[model samples]
Target: MTSAPPTTEPWAAPHARGPVQAAVSLPGSKSLTNRALVLAALAEGPSVVRRALRSRDTLLMAGALTALGARVETATDDWTVEPAPLVGGGSVDCGLAGTVTRFVPPVAGLADGPVAFDGDPGMRTRPVGEVLTALRALGVRIDGDRLPFTVHGTGSLRGGRVVLDASGSSQFVSALLLAGARFEEGLDLLHDGKALPSQPHIDMTVAMLRGHGVEVDDGEPARWRVAPGPILAVDQSIEPDLSNAAAFLALAATTGGRVTVRDWPAQTTQAGDAIRDLLGRMGCSVLRDELGLTVTGSDRIKGIDVDLHEVGELTPVVAALCALADGPSYLRGIAHIRGHETDRIAALATELRGLGADVTELADGLELRPATLHGGLFRSYADHRMAHAAAVLGSAVEGVRVDDVAATSKTFPDFPAVWSALLDAR
Candidate 1:
């Protein structure tokens, strides 16, 4: 097992005033990168992936593919994957990446060997039973309900109608879709009564599948039918992550400064675009150019009530921005956050309170009042999002210290360096 990275303390002095200009080549989307890795591993021949994210999440996915018999090599910014027949199956450690932990197992079900999937403590707690149950229905062998779980691949998986409960995370549904091509008859997926929280993420999954030459029939009420076929390999570039874009967007709101993010795609299915509308309602001047986006902070931000069901992952960042607003902000429709890398709702509330914000954790979401934030040491709880959220909030307050800054490696490995660049540009 690889050792976790060293922890660091992240502290930020309040920005006095300035316009921030930066041309950043943001890392590739971890979500897309992982999905592509899985699909490429399942493809027939060699596939070239350009500008693949090298962050911890994608690294775990790549390593898992290597464990599954795919030969992976890196050359400069591109990763070349030569798919091999699944010969030897062994244990795959997913580290702290929930995407890799949940999504990898289902793809492994199509292999010929018994693959044991496990992860870091955080990934172990995330629910994989939904995918496991679906795989079992498709004639795959699954052992137990928790990590260190084993999947005995049957070489061929049969397609069946499955009603998925995806409220917790969309990765389960995406995983099934990626592996659908190998199934004998393919799959027809139906969503349970619970509403799909992050529809855009699901859309992104489908889009990437299509790019990989897999055909999916997207129907109404969240029904999808994937045909069993070979996935055609192609050279593809991953788009900028909207989730990563949120932190910099919040920077503008926190400092009353102007910051621009370059190389951001104009069109994206990522749910994090909710930040634009959400921030606009919060009284920030957000402008998008052909190159990227520019957000100018307002002198006084006004809070608004909103539901973040589709963009639940952005809840913490939104809550942090709301703390600097003029009035109380109400955010709902994110009850599933409790099951993420950490109990995000409770963790955010605790850390925000530590920064002197009046925050209440509701069953589904949170209510935050605009209060002066005092910089103090904040805990990351070993969660990357928690660490990034605390660091972004710390930029708005004096003397803010974020413990375990290294946790950001899970998604953006160069978070501290990126934040430093943004600060320097200001």
Candidate 2:
């Protein structure tokens, strides 16, 4: 987390006096960048991840890999990961990153000694027990069930059949599959709980595994078979982070402005890509061309009734948009988000209500009714998505302030600058 220190000073959220016209180029996808780094570290040869996101979460991942004996050169936009003999006796700081907490343990299980893992004070509540318990069932010696645990490896793991509940997060599924190819007997993972969240994230994991020359059989529902073999190294270029572009695009959707996000991929498995359809349903004009993707707001922002179980990360910003709508909205099927960086549903309800919106926090989602919005202090809860949500409402609601705008650097390093630039757009 090389971002600026968290401050007590509240940042006044910029308001759009009129329609905004802006075009901005976003950074690389953190999801893709972290996954690429892990795979490259486990590959048979050196791998290059071009245009990787140099944010807090991704940097934590790179650091974890380095702690486990991989040489990760992140000095440039392109990061080169050199695979070395897996050793242990290292400690990894998870740093409030769900990816780091979930993804690194499997890799740590292949090291020669004991590797310790811990994260931010807030990450204590997040779930890593599912992954840790599953790794134990797959023949890895683990000291604890959650963060602040240690993986005692004998330089290998006996991975085979393991079934556990992954309903809480898709990262658990991805964590196992990423290192399954290196397991001695390979891996057969099954989900024996409720429905999984973020199916696209799991799909993304599968695609990346295949791209790295690892064989994965996900032909059956809720079941994946990974065949043990050498992971092939491949040079790769990352797609722009559409998720980070959400708050920026929200500026247009709220103010009848026009915003273009540069280098939007024509096809993607990114969950953030769903924002186009989401915004469109809210009466925003969406167009995709060689210039990239553009979203223009309508005279009125309409409330939507939609299920966000597959795209829970977008909940905060979507909830903010719902707060700005003239009508009511029902966002459901995302109860799993209770386990995110913060309890997002509760945080949204508290913050929105504080900002003078009619908000009802439900067990699975939220119910937002139209109300006149006013500005108060909007706190970010040390969660980047929370900060993005604050900015969304603040754009229309006057006198909005964010407690810690630097929290945006978790994935979007240039967020403050980009936001100022967006407001300056005419």
Candidate 3:
């Protein structure tokens, strides 16, 4: 584990004012980067992935692929992968990336050796039973349904209908879909309840698979079918992360500054697009241009009552913004936040309470009142979103001390730097 430098200087609060202007570029999406890395590693020929996210999560995925016998090289915004038969018989440290821990194991099942998947303490607590059950149904030898688990692949997988209780993370379904081509009959997925959260992520998964020549048929809410086919090598560029864009948007809104993020695609399957509509409701002037998105700060942020089902990942950022709004904000449709890097709703509520905000955590979501924020020491719970949320709060309040600041490396390793740049631009 690399030691992150200490943030000895306390974050100073931004004075509430009017239109600040800046241009910012966020790291590529960890979701897209890891998925592309896995696909590239499984391809028949050498492939180049451009603008890959260089965060800890994506790096862990890349390391896992390399350990499984893929030769990967990186050169300034590009990654070249040379596929070789997976050596199989090795233990893979997935770090704290749930995506890598859950998604890579199924793919590793196609290798010739026993692959043991493990991660940080938090990753071990996250449930992988749904994926394990599905893999077991397909004849993979899985010792347990939890992390620190071992899988021995048989070089070929038998695919069939698998009933998955994805809970909220779409990576489980995505993992199976991405590796479906290597199966004899492909994969069929069945949902047990109201389907998983972040459904758009699943759509993104299907879209990426189709781009590589694999076909998946959507048969309704719970049923999905994938046809066996060979994945052709193709050069692909990942879209700029909409999730990371939220923090800057919030910064603009809170400080009454105008911030623009470059290279953001207008039409994206990501759930973070809900930020645009949500920001509009908060009285921010939002403009979508050919190059990217511009959000101008409002005189006063307004509270909103809405369900953030699709854009659940942005819940923490939005909720933090709500703490500075004019009235009480109620956010619903995020019961799954409890299962993320931390019990986000509870953690956010607790932290906000420490900052003197009238925040309450419900069974499904949270209700926060607009109040004067005071700075204090903030704990991140080692969750990346928590760290970012704390930073946003710090921007709005003085003397905010954030512990575990380095936790941002999980997604945006350069978060502190990017945040500093945004501040400097102001």
Candidate 4:
């Protein structure tokens, strides 16, 4: 995959001239779309994924599956996935997506040939060894324990009882679980790690597996049992990306305006679903109605003490809101975010500090103390969420230009145009 867009010039983030009002219709959930792609590609028959995200990450996932012999047709309408006898002897470009690198290897193990996986230079540094090592212990022949590794697919995996620490990422657990039922012996996986982050994501995986007719017994914490069975083909409908919506919702919160995200689900395992309660705690009036989920900003944004362990992906945007809050805020239980696209805690602290907020980077999270802010250039470090943090702050703090705004294309390729339309609707 191509490296993130060049960063020779900074994009001038639109500063809100007044209280903005608009309805923002976001795209499908990257989380759901990627997961659906994997499950559908391993199902007994052809399956459909409605409203699947067409961004870099989801496309990379489709490409990876296709490389492993699955027939995935990406259309202007919807994506159709047809399962094929997985035979490898192909290469996978994971780009900078954690989902692709973390989720594809186990599936590759079930293929018949060798599959090599690699990605951007920075992705090489991301944490992927745990899952890779686990695969090795499960009788898959793997060349390395990280990105830039090769999985020698043997047309089958003897998947049963493997234990590992999943503290670094929930993706490791979800990855193993997604492909577990396909293993000849199925899988009895156990996590012998510290508290798992993003439990909801694992729940989403389990729920989706069951929806596809696979038996997943996650009754006990940190342990999962997948029975060997055929995954039934079903058309899956993905919800709007609530994590991406957090950026827009933050725009409303900081500018004391109103913003609505269309088609917010009543229930979901997406970690982004935590935005409703979290935004509400931060002094935004969150309402779910026929129109969808709406956030009406109060006169003053409130600081909050929240533990985002299960919803760590929302940290960047939430931290941006905290930087503009009316009081000190402590965001805890998300140290795992540091291993994300960038060192998220450090990135947030530095950028918010550059914008004149009193920020402290903790070993596990961040502590933001409200302060007067001014405009300046914010570096995205080629991270989509970091670019998002800058945009949220720029809406209120004038002249906050963001470098490599194109990094948002990792998920939302139309972020700039859609954001501009939302503001211009005022």
lDDT (CA) for every model shown? 0.80, 0.92, 0.81, 0.90
Q: How well does each candidate superpose onto the true structure, as a TM-score? A: 0.95, 0.98, 0.95, 0.98
lDDT of 4 by residue, 83-156 (tens): 99998889999999999999999999999989999998879888999998899999888998677899999999
| Pairs with steric clashes in candidate 4 | none
State each candidate's clash count. Answer: 0, 0, 2, 0
Query: Which candidate gets the maximum lDDT versus the true structure?
Result: 2
lDDT of 3 at 396: 70
- After superposing candidate 2, which stretches have Cα over 4 Å from the reference? 1-6
lDDT of 1 by residue, 1-426 (tens): 112343654545344345454546578888777888888888878888888988888888888989888988865568989888774368788887878778877778877889988878767777778888888877788998778789998766787688778877777788788888777888888768577777888898899888878889996677888888888887778777778888887887777777777776788877777788887898889888886888888777788799988888888788878887889999999887888888888888888898899989899989998788888877777877777787677777668877778888887888887887777767
Q: Which prediction has more favorable TM-score, 1 or 2?
A: 2
Give the per-residue lDDT of model 3 (tens digit) for 117-178.
88887777766788888899888998877778999987778887788787667777888888
Please give the lDDT score at residue 367 for candidate 3.
Answer: 95
Cα RMSD of predicted structure 3? 2.5
Write down the worst ten-residue block by lDDT for model 4: 1-10
Q: Could you tell me the C-alpha RMSD of candidate 2 in Å? A: 2.1
Instruction: State which candidate, 1 or 3, has the greater lDDT.
Output: 3
Of models 3 and 4, which has the larger TM-score? 4
